[model samples]
Target: MAGRQGGHHIACTGLSAFPLTPMRDDAVDERAFAAQVARVAASGVDSIGALGSTGVYPYLSRAERARVARVTVEHADGVPVIVGVGSLRTSHVLEHVDDAVEAGAAAVLLPAMSYHPLTDDDVIGLVETVAAHSPAPVIVYDNPGTTHITFTQELYARVARVPGVVSIKIPGVPTEPAAAREHVATIRGAVSEDVTIGVSGDPFATAGLAAGCDAWYSVIAGTVPEVAVRLARPALAGNAAEADAENARLAPLWQLFTEMGGSIRVIAAIAELLGIAEQPCLPLPIRGLDGEQRRRVAAVLETLDHAAEPDRDE
Candidate 1:
């Protein structure tokens, strides 16, 4: 459920689905992207993360990103949209933030999108700068894999103090229950009580939520949202056994994520397979999954065919 802080509605808690910014040829497939947004919004997820890493944030141009943000908010159908506004240059990130707010974003996810080695202070400064100017609340995105910027507990604490920061999207957490709890507990101690902690890295989602994360910033939720919701609803509701059972059921898919590299390509493959987006929908250079790999994804999908079926339980 979403919580209100003072006046701002913080929709950072629960499952926040991240949809692909589907592309056709070299340009953004606005129609396809909007459909993805509409699909996720209709899934009853708590929020929609428009342009996180799963959405291929770095590859898109400012204009494309602005259009994607506009399309996401417009199609989200009142679902809170958290647009990612991370860029190489701080100024450009702020500009993206402006575009996102203009497009009706409820919050912004700012990763330390770095090319050069960035000091901790540099990252903190970037957050402070954007938070001061951004009309929407900020989500400190600690995505070390893409950003190559590992945020220490101290770094998280320092940035969470920024006036407008409302959430922190941690990359992942420990798989073991005790370890995951300790890990999330340390970060929880560092931020404000109201600053929601959302877990990325879909495979670790149940563990993270079980360990006390406020949300699941899910990649798989973008393509096969009903399945994601199946797990997330139980997990967020404190149904540990049901959540763990669902996690075990999706073990094949999670293993595929590792075997295939990461969620980006696998999810793109799923979207294409489901006819939710076009073939070769991802931006160029990232050819998505190859034919053989796609076949494997297809096989996996067959086993999880229930994903495409309606959630009659709902």
Candidate 2:
């Protein structure tokens, strides 16, 4: 797996936080979104991902998405901002990339979006074309859960060879600590050593880092960045025992994410509970957490926040 190497590395290793796109009355809440970005940056996350899956990229119009990207970069406060540029069409994806670049984003994340299942060659062509067109570095997002297209190790190796492709964000968590380690090692061996491998699905972050993945592309961090930093710091520092302990503390929140269907609902509820934004998601049929669900989520968030607080005596 070899190709020309000219992609600019955006220093996105470690805990890369994905911030949710706060909405107000079916419109992108620019002020709330900027506050969210600032909050994550203040929490010491390595990078900020705007318009990620949790950001509801597909649900928003191009102009709205571009505005989010611009606000994210502006509020990131020198922290690198990675903009998601995934669209069903290659041409549209390229347009998004240009918008991200023009908006001063540091990097771009591209997922293979398809209404029909894509072949290996089709996926490869998509990445190559995007990488060739993107002025900034491209992070290949392999989220089979949403896109229904998985990037195997072989495909990753091929995509890694594309010029300007600097990283890959893989989804799902490994079954165990050992499996997580093995998974990272296998992917690292398959691609160029210079290529960073980041794992999404926040619950798997500790294990992914313990296994040696370079970064954690987190959903939970979109709202609760402090918890994410606590988990990431230990894992990145090679403190497996501490990382595992942190992960244990996060178990309740992770459970809520699983029970609530996904992070979007739970995070929207958390954002509202924290008074950061109002409860608004992608329109009907894809609503935010209901009243009962909000109460339950608020309870969990309260408990977690209390547990994370430092002792007053100290």
Candidate 3:
């Protein structure tokens, strides 16, 4: 790991997760947002991902994203803030990367979002375009759950070899253990094991860590970070059993947000319930959670808090 490439290693080592901050009439409640980041940072989270899928990235204007990134970085002090730069076009996303870097983000996380499915060559080209233009190191996000396509191990290896590409964020596709381990072993054997492979989904983070993934990029990390920090840090350090126990405790909240119909929308609503944001406003076409879903989600959150406390004692 010691070479010219080794200098960028720090960008990939941390727990990268975003906080969902609900908006009130197209405006962010900065006070609430800052407090949320501060609380998460104080709980020992490695990095804060602002203006991400959890943070309602699609709803914010470019200017709003910049301001939120700046404020989040300010509140986090020395903690790294990885700003999302996912957009419809390369130029627009590149500009967002510029704004993120200017706002003092340590790195920029980007999704592969070109029209239609992308080939390995296309994925490599897209990663190169962003890495070449970004002011900071680029972390490629492979989220086939939301996005239409995911980069293959061949493409991931190629991009990992790129000059400015330091990290890759892969969502854990399997919700079960045997399959999850297979997914990790396959990817680790395919890519340079030295390149940091981060798991994004909550259900898969523990399994991903147990299977030797370097870090986690989680949305659940945003709302109830104490649980994420307490559990994930140990998992990354190679304690799979303890990690799984913690995951079991928090599984209800994870299932509520992700397993339900409107995962993203439900998350926004929960952010409001937790008092982290004023309103649960998503981008156009992504509506708020229904009343019944909100009640169920709230009930699960209570269980998460109760379950998390005992695990911390362990």
Candidate 4:
């Protein structure tokens, strides 16, 4: 769990916002991206993860991804930044790790990217190699949805043995809330206590935290850090009532995300709706919501904003 260069150890707990990388003219829009990062940093998130799936890391070129990481660190304004360094090739992942370390990232989120199904040994090797080379601590990102490589409790235990592998981001268990809780417990039991277990996929966050997850690697936090924090604080403190109440309020937003494919597309539309950025997303096959879709998102945002405002005593 020690950081490189005597830096602070990566604290993989609380809300870590995975902000979108704004794009313009088919390239990263530096100005817009900075603004978004600054906004999230100021919103009281525990950390910022740049170039994640939500950040369209796979879509951007290595140079662009590196630039985004540096920019994220700069705009994080003292908040820890965890840069995603997942790539198809282990060597390419190392290059990303170097970039993140050079940019002073607090940690690197490493996902085993593979076209062919990866064996448990393949995942272990990938993580060991990346952690060996990375100056920053490596967070094994177990996102089966995108990477198609799921990390079992046994695999997590093996990866935790790798030096500098400090945390794991478990993809949220979408169904059977009890199963999600059990899944978190299983991972928690299997891995060393030092290897923090965080949950991704915002809808499952409340249950995940209730189930003993250490942190929430959230897409919703990227757009609405205040809301995410409100929900997380209560949940993490074992206040299930308050946490569930807050989560219930966000059900509509989560429903929208599910209806519109997924968080990547919906979140990009959300950023645009909030004026945090203009059409921040990857190009076609992964485009943002259209005008009509945006209006629906705007409506939900307005409702959420109103509900979040403190009531005035007459």
Candidate of highest TM-score: 1
Q: What are the Cα lDDT values of the candidates?
A: 0.87, 0.82, 0.73, 0.82
Instruction: List residue ranges in candidate 1 displaced over 4 A.
Output: 1-8, 305-314
Per-residue lDDT of model 3, residues 171-200, tens digit only? 774767788788888877777655678888
Backbone clash tally (model 4): 0
For candidate 4, write residues 1-314 as lDDT tens digits. Answer: 34453133458888899988878778898887887788789988899999888888888888999999889988888899999999999899999988888888989999888898889998888988888888788888988879998777789899987888878898876446678777777788888888888889899899898888898999878766787888988988999999999989989998997898778777787776666666545555666777788788888887674212221122
Candidate 1 lDDT over 65-148, as tens digits, reads 999998988898888888999999999999999998888888888999899989999998999998888888889899888899
lDDT (Cα, tens digit) per residue for candidate 2, span 89-187: 999999899889888888898999889999999999999898878778889999887888978889999998887888899986694988887888889
Clashes of each: 0, 0, 0, 0
Where model 4 places Cα greater than 4 Å from the true spot, the runs are: 1-9, 174-178, 306-314
Candidate 2 vs. true structure, TM-score: 0.93
Over 4 Å off, model 2 = 1-9, 306-314
Tell me how many residue pairs clash in candidate 1: 0
Ranking by TM-score: 1, 2, 4, 3
